[model samples]
Target: MAKKHKPRVKAPKTASPGEVMEIKTLISHEMESGQRKDRKTGELIPRQIINRFECKYNGETVFSADMHPAISANPYMAFYVKAGESGELEFLWHDDNGDVYSHSQKLEVA
Candidate 1:
């Protein structure tokens, strides 16, 4: 059985008007690459990894990335975005197992 996934996000609660803010994200995942075999069963493991990642600010896409099996477990990403107004920042990670893990944060610009 697969373990539950936990996602973490880091962003400033407030930012200066039009200033660039750094965003960091990380998620717990095994990120199986499908290249190994079970020791007992001797069967090839299936590939299961976070295939995509996206970030949206104020309902608009800000940063996005396409990942592959080469990515390591517990993937971490850091990016930058311009602060706009008070709104929500949504982060999403899509896995090969049809699972979508998400997290959100509120940012206020002064």
Candidate 2:
């Protein structure tokens, strides 16, 4: 079984309509590239990494990224979102092994 990962997201609790706000996200994961060998067994460690990341505002995609093996563990990303209305900002991370980590924050736009 894959290990549990912790996802973190930061967004403004309130903002003015049409305002541009900075959003930050981070996930705790050990991104193994599958190229390294086990010290004792001398076997290749299975590759495990976050393969994709996406952000949605009010159910609409705002930002997305495709990650590669070269990405380091605990990936951190920051992006900008233009406030439109009060809604949910959802963050999702897709792992190579069919695992998905998700988090959401409410944004109140006036």
- List candidate 1 stretches off by more than 4 Å: 1-3
Consecutive 10-residue window with the lowest summed lDDT within model 1:
1-10
Give the TM-score comparing model 2 with the true structure, all chains together. Answer: 0.93
Model 2 worst lDDT window (10 residues): 1-10
Query: Cα deviation in Å at residue 89, candidate 1?
Result: 0.4
Provide the TM-score for each candidate, comma-separated.
Answer: 0.94, 0.93
lDDT of 1 by residue, 1-110 (tens): 36567899998999998999999899999899999899999999989999999999999998999998889999999999999898999999999989899998898989
C-alpha lDDT (0 to 100) for residue 74 of candidate 1: 96
